[model samples]
Target: MLQQSSAALASVFDRASEDYDRTGAAFFTPLGRRLVEKARVEPGSSVLDVGCGSGACLFPAALATGPKGRVVGIDLAPGMVGRARRAAESQRLGNVSVQLMDAFRPEFHGARFDFVLSSMVLVWLPDSAEVLERYRPLLNPGGRFAFCNPRLTGQDGIPFVPEIFGTVMESVGVHPKTFFEDLDNGWLGAPDAALLKAGYTGIEVCDETYSLELLSGEDWVRWSWSHGFRSFWERVPQARLGELEKEVAEGIDLLRDSDGVIRIPGTVRYVSAST
Candidate 1:
């Protein structure tokens, strides 16, 4: 089941690779930078970025580590790996390499990395605890592991933007409660506890809220299909996708401010621990 889920996730990301973080929305890139910041990556460090989609976290870490350091990024999606590799080459980043690899079972020598980072990836894994343990051995002594997850809030127990998608999905007779339920179940309740259980120390968890500004409702629809939310968009039948998008656009437009910007608020939890 885990392998099947990973394959499905890779396929979804592969399909989304072209527009993954290209949408004008200030979401993934900003969050990736924030995670790198929280990780406190330094020059000459050896960094491993798991699930490095489109080099969001990978590039920043590479920049932080400077020319003397080495940054390796891995992803299960071949398209994502290809995109990251091209981006690295285009930028002339000789110190960076992106490879197609499974995050759950990373093939690396023990204690090979000074830092390991992931952004918005753990919540999708069914065995996050075991994965945390698996990643621990990859970090060298005193090395740090850092990652981020959405801090779900609101009456429906999800972020505001996703709540809108759920409501729109239900309007089209496709229930999204199961999806959100699975999401809620997958995210760790006490990430620090999980880290401690995984034999990590010096744990730190922080939360920050970010506002995603969309130029218009149409922009929101485009941004939705760019990231993991694409899964929800894919659930709608092709014949009903247009109808769903139109309604979602209208629904999102209603919440637009006087300046015509649709700002969706979400909180992200960043966690770091030392090996």
Candidate 2:
């Protein structure tokens, strides 16, 4: 069952394809950006954006590398790749390109990057440690590998409904996994200590917790239902789904004050190592 769920998650972003760029960017959590900064690419350096997700992390990367350097974003979903390409073109960024490809099967084909970066996408892979080991051979010496590791953050910041997740599962006689895979074990500690056990060097890891604000309850919940946790919603009871949405909104309201601003707690783990 875990295997099937993992496989589905690998492909699930397709359902959120259309709204991903707009919604994710709007809700673009700060942790991802901080991770990219730690990568510290220089002008003319080559960079790879794994799980690019409509290039949410690419634009800043392009600017970081300047015009001489090139940024390539690879995503498993064809829809995301297409949207990324459109996004690059809209910004007229000549140095960045988006491609549809799997990180597990990196057919870079004639390209080597100075930095290989992934943000919040590693949780789905059971063999992420091995995957990083595979990436080492492709990086230029002194190049860095980095990603934003989450500590069960963003639930409160969500602009849509997730307060109904447990009820949604109960209604169907099932257990509901949260919007994410619950990778919280290592935001401050090594979730995957095996990463260093593998032959990588110059390791530095740290986590920071922060608060993120979203418009209101409904928008946050709707966005989560549409993008962040679509699979959870699909398996939920169809009849009582609206109730779940309402419950989610009510929960969000309770978390707020007289000013009506909803604040969600977020924790980010940032890790970087030399390849």
Cα lDDT tens digits, model 1, 115-172, are 9999988877657778989998889899999999877643534654745677888776
Q: Using Cα atoms with residue i matched to residue i, what is each candidate's TM-score against the true structure?
A: 0.94, 0.85
lDDT of 2 at 1: 15
Candidate 1 root-mean-square deviation in Å: 2.1
lDDT of model 1 at position 67 = 100
Candidate 1 C-alpha error for residue 237, in Å:
1.9
User: Which candidate wins on TM-score?
Assistant: 1
lDDT of each: 0.84, 0.68
| TM-score, candidate number 1 | 0.94
Candidate 2 error regions (>4 Å): 1-7, 24-26, 152-192
Error of 1 at 133 (Å): 0.6
Model 1 lDDT-worst window of ten: 153-162
Candidate 2 structure quality by residue, lDDT tens digits, 1-275: 12124346556787778876454324443555676687776788889988888775777788888899999998887777888899899989999998877777788666678998888777655556667777777788888888765555444422222345455455666444433433433232363455566556888777676554666777666666545366666766788778877777776667775676776666666778886
Could you say which candidate leads in lDDT? 1
